[model samples]
Target: MDLECSDLFEWHMQSGHGKVYADSFALFISIPLASLCVLILIS
Candidate 1:
């Protein structure tokens, strides 16, 4: 029972880590694109 719980916790942590990494990557891509769009609009 304890082992099963630990495994589940680890799995959840891994999934959460993946989500966080993907979110940051998306933010990085979006921020640059947004900045470029804003610059184009100003120009």
Candidate 2:
């Protein structure tokens, strides 16, 4: 049971990191697109 818990914790940590990275990448892409949209609207 201890080993299982440890494995689960490690998996969760890895998945959490991946989720954070994906969120960051999405935000990075979105900022440029958002700026472009704002510019278009202004024009």
Candidate 3:
């Protein structure tokens, strides 16, 4: 039972990390795209 609980905890932690990584990647991509759009509008 304890081992199962630990495994579940680890799985949740990994999933949380994945979500954070994906969010960071999306933000990185969006910031560059937004900057490009702004530059195009200015020019």
Candidate 4:
């Protein structure tokens, strides 16, 4: 997961549109993932 994130970051840094897409994409993915983690911990 970390490696994938790093790769995405590197790819995004190489392009303007990719950077915007990556930032929003990361936010979208991370919110759901973080909520899942919290739910697991609460359970």
What do the candidate models score in CA lDDT, each in turn?
Answer: 0.83, 0.84, 0.84, 0.90
The candidate maximizing lDDT is: 4
**Tens digit of per-residue lDDT, candidate 1, span 1-43:** 9999888767855885867766788899999999999999999
Task: Give per-residue lDDT, candidate 1, residue 5.
Answer: 81
> In each prediction, how many residue pairs overlap at the backbone (N, C-alpha, C within less than 3 A)?
0, 0, 0, 0
In model 4, residue pairs whose N, Cα or C atoms come closer than 3 Å (at least 3 residues apart or on different chains), thus clashing, are: none
Candidate 3 least-lDDT 10 residues: 9-18
Query: How does candidate 3 score on lDDT?
Result: 0.84
Candidate 4 positional error at 9, Å: 12
Candidate 2 C-alpha error for residue 12, in Å: 12
In model 1, which range of ten residues has the least summed lDDT? 9-18
Off by over 4 Å in 1: 1-14
The predicted structure with the larger TM-score, 2 or 4, is: 4
Q: Please provide TM-scores, in order, for all candidate models, with all chains considered together.
A: 0.62, 0.61, 0.62, 0.62
Tens digits of per-residue lDDT for model 2, 1-43: 9999888766855885867766788899999999999999999
Clashing pairs in 1: none
Candidate 3 local Cα displacement, residue 19, angstroms: 1.0
Query: What TM-score quantifies how close candidate 2 is to the native fold?
Result: 0.61
Q: Residue 4 error for model 1, in Å? A: 29
